[model samples]
Target: MKRIIIASVAAAALVGGGTAFAVASDGTDSARSSSTAFQATAARASLSDAAHAALKAVPGTLDSIERDHGRWEADVLGQDGTWHEVTLDANAKVIDQRVDRDTDAEDAAEAKALRNADVSATEAARKASSGTVTSVEFDDDRTPVWEVETVTNHKERDLTVDAHSGKVTQAPADDDHGDDDSGDDD
Candidate 1:
């Protein structure tokens, strides 16, 4: 009788452990499916749509818009003379917005550049490539250009379009991940 009881308990524990493992595996699969769905939705989003959504939500002048980490982020100069950071979901829905209290000279310069830019973000994206635009931001490089990122055939391409002349050029690869190989902090 004692031996039978021990065997029964052991079998029950093994079955319970297997059931738990199956449940955990299903949970992982569900999470993966949800993530894939989100990426698909984000892929359908366009720079134009995200810009419109951000502007509508914040009621401000769009300084820059970029798709980062599966969401759309926009920097805008509010009518109140304050900078704002707006985050939008994959569907271009405003998810969160915050005032940029730590405004700096760079922010002002970007705004000024946007005001003087002859090529609109939409225009730059159109001229840059036929790929899906992921980001559009004005870079105040020596020549001043609109840096655009796009995904074509599952590959990311970075191009710079002249802010004034609308000329497009392939941007040099940015392999430096803050390594500072030159050993110069400045």
Candidate 2:
């Protein structure tokens, strides 16, 4: 029943017929380019040693990562079990850092949930798609799944994997994000 809910959510989030990707036949540039872009992002992600270095600078457990506004952004769980949003430049220099928006209670819950995840972020990204992992998170599900984001072929993608079962599902792109390239290097 839970898997059913998960599948339903994914089908609604990704595409018709409970599929993980949009078929080329869909003919929407947004749809087709997303996959292509993902490939591009994935292709390029592995080359960013700076993002990795920025991640290592964080003083705790790592959470999720993603590229936004032309920079590699990450969420790290500190040794105190708090989440921090960190950004790194192309040279891997830390350009910004701050505490995550979640409340301390939320942080505690996420930290506790992190221990049960059998799949690491790198493994989860590889299983979801061929790219560099940008971010990872423990979903708010009762069972707690891993929500991982990756960049490949100059595209972005989201994948959800069961923390214990290793079940993976690719999500559809929702670009309605009100974010902008304020931090992007122009």
**Candidate 2 — number of clashing residue pairs?**
22
lDDT of 2 by residue, 1-186 (tens): 544654455546433212242232234545443342111111123423544665577766556666554456777777766678888754456788988775777667777777667765555656776576666666654776778776677577777887777888875565655567545444
Q: Model 2 Cα RMSD, Å?
A: 15.9
Model 1 deviation from native, Cα RMSD in Å:
11.8
Compared with the true structure, what per-residue lDDT tens digits does model 1 show for residues 1-186? 544554555455443322111111233435543331111222346789899998888886676799876678998877776889999886788899999899788877877777788887778988986698888887875777888999887788999999899999999988776776957576
Candidate 2 off by > 4 Å: 1-51, 100-102, 131-135, 150-157, 172-186
Q: Specify the highest-lDDT model's number.
A: 1
